[model samples]
Target: MSALGTPRPSPLPAPPPGAPTVSAPEPQEPRSRKWIVWLVLILVGGLVVWQAAVKPRMEAQAERASAVSAIKAAKVFAGTLARTVRVSGPTSSQEYTSITAPIMRGPEAGRELTLLYLVDSGKIVKKGELIAQIDAKTLEDHIDDIGDDIERAEADVRKRRAEQAIETENLTQTIRVAQAELDKAILEEKASETRTVIDRELLKLAVEEAQARLNQTKADVAHKLQAHKSELRILEITKERHVRHRDRHKTDLVKFKMYSPMDGLAVVQMTWRGGEYGVIRQGDNVTPGMLFLKVVNPAKMQVEGQVNQSESSLFRIGQKARIRLDAFPELNLAGKVHSIGALAAGGWRQSYYIRNVPVRITFTEVHNKVIPDLSAAADVTITEEENVKQLALAAVRREEGKDVVYVRKGDQFERREVKLGLSNNTHAAVLSGLEVGEEVALEKPAIQMAALR
Candidate 1:
């Protein structure tokens, strides 16, 4: 208000000396609050986007990745392909000697024989080596009893001969006495001229009676001699019967001790006893004629296997085979088909049309580890080829009457038709369409399944 009606400004007051200065906080702007709200909304929107779209996309991508990873694939290779007729069965010997329990005769017949001694299974034995022994005690006792009977019969024979000698001597003495009596009567008849007629007639009658008695005595002696011979014959026959019995028992006793007839491995066979089938052990009783052991000539070893009737045509005598022992995998043997059954055999429980042919494979190469009854497999090579490109049979699929393989190209498989040549169980020859070292899916691609879904 001092100069042209305009008010003048006044001067501010200063703080007190030594007092602390105080500052007030500035107020926040509305634009700043708006910016904070927009930031929170953006974060929420980002979370919603992750839940509805981005995460699902990532999950689906992971699933696709997993599906792609799940597909099994293999690379093709070039090698020899052998088409083989595979057969499986227990190993056996082509030239083996079988030892069985002896059929007991005489007193010991109709009874099981007890095993007294058994050689260790799989023992290498020479020809004539003792492989097993049955209890010979029974047969031995039987032989002893028969011997006693034979001895008794022999003694009876001798005694009867002596008795016959004594009886014949007595008869001879009787005949001599009768002759002397007849002679005395003859002398008395000669004195008949000095006696009465009655006395002479009586003397003649006495002579006649004496002569008849002498003849009767001689005839009786002849009959008695025949009887003695017949009695001796009967005794000799009895003794002979006993002797035969003893001999038979001795033979059976000898058979009780079994011997290996061949120079090879001695393998005990399983026998049915006590309602179960098992190897014959010491003290185990076995029926007569039951096969108890085998003397297997490993030199002539073979594998006896069954082949499907349809596949029997592939086998022929002298065809080469490769044998592998399941017990010893390291042993690979060369063999040849030696024999095939002329008839097909089928199990009663199976279909009548389902038949199998027995095939015999003789081993060309011998290994010590090869033995009888071991589970073995034979691959009889029917045909073979070299430098053939092949893929697993599973990798090839039949489509529209054509062989197609799923060839892997990057992350996907491309279906390709391939020309095939000779094939086997495990692999198929790739003649044209497939190349070596190319990966092919062994199974259906999971990527294809996902696409279909």
Candidate 2:
């Protein structure tokens, strides 16, 4: 044992036997991890390729197949086909009375007529009911003045007649007195034989003088009588003129109170005032001959529409129509064309090149919701066919100067030519080359396939 506290290392024993010189086994080299990293990288690369390229391509192919199988198509059907022209305008009563401001006469003429009373708009009124009244105070005053003038004229006529009678009576007395004097003179002349020659000569001259005076007096009486007749005639003519004037004013007074000519709904008219168009109300000043209101019979209504000149030929009297009021969505009434204008007229607010023909449609059925001046649209049937083959317009395609449709045949669409008759916006009447229950592609099959791809 060593003196120090540390113990000595133990010595290895030598391999004594020569069976094998065993050396310490060499440390085997550690396997590399690079192959495992490469394998992980390879697997990651394959995953990226599948997500970015393979999956999207597979999805696209699936969608293309679905679109090719899902092409939209429709079948030709037998139905009632009608060609209609849409006309829109305002609805109005067929029977209506236009009420205008009364034209004043006499001194009130040319003056602005003020409305004193006005009925409420949209009021139901009976015939002969007062609808409006113009301010007649001025007119009434003028009439009174005319009446006074007429009275004065009549008085003057009577006074002139009395004066003429008195004058005639005095003239008659003068004529009688002159005749008596002439008689006295003649009697004196006859007594000449009882007197001397000088006395006889004086009596003869006195008789001649008296006779001349009587003739002159008679002439004066005739002239004065004629003059009196002329003066009386002038007075009578003046009085007649005043009476006629009064009568004219009386007629005008009656006009001031306006009445409904027929039982109807009273609708006030719009007038231009205060720089804008508005309804005429009480206290508004209306001019002579100006239309202020209307009395429209609601039971008898019509639509006044104007159609293009090109379409005028399609419209004729007695054509059936379906009317729709824009104000009331639920009301659909039947009507017919009542009249068509013989000559087309150009609208004042439209272009000069545009001409429209006036059309009137009378309602065959009355509805309580219908009212005058409401905006309405009508479908006038120009031609109609029942139980005819009709095809959807979307199914048609114009190709090579002809109309063609894609008729479905098994798994393919065959392009087929078709003859079209009456056509509207949505469908066309198939006159030939198409049968009922045949399916036609709404969209081009080739185009839809290409678009999906």
Candidate 2: tens digits of C-alpha lDDT, residues 173-266: 9989999999999999888899999999889998998999999999999999999989988988888887878788888889989888899999
1-453 in candidate 1: lDDT tens per residue? 432333455644777999887665544444656777789899999999999999999988777666665788889999999999888999888888888888866665779788989988888999887788888876777788888999999999999999999998998898899889889988888889988888888999999999998899889888988998999999999999999889888878878888777798888878677788787778888888888788878888888888988888888899998999988988888999999999999977999989999999989998888888999999999998999999998888888999898988865788999999999989978889988999998887754656645
lDDT of each: 0.85, 0.88
Name the 10 consecutive residues with the lowest summed lDDT in model 2.
Answer: 1-10
Estimated TM-score per prediction?
0.74, 0.78
The TM-score measured for candidate 1 stands at 0.74
User: Taking the candidates one at a time, how many backbone clashes does each contain?
Assistant: 0, 0
CA shift of 417, model 2, Å = 4.1
Q: After superposition, how far is residue 303 of candidate 2 from its true place, in Å?
A: 2.1
Residue 12 accuracy (lDDT) in model 1: 47
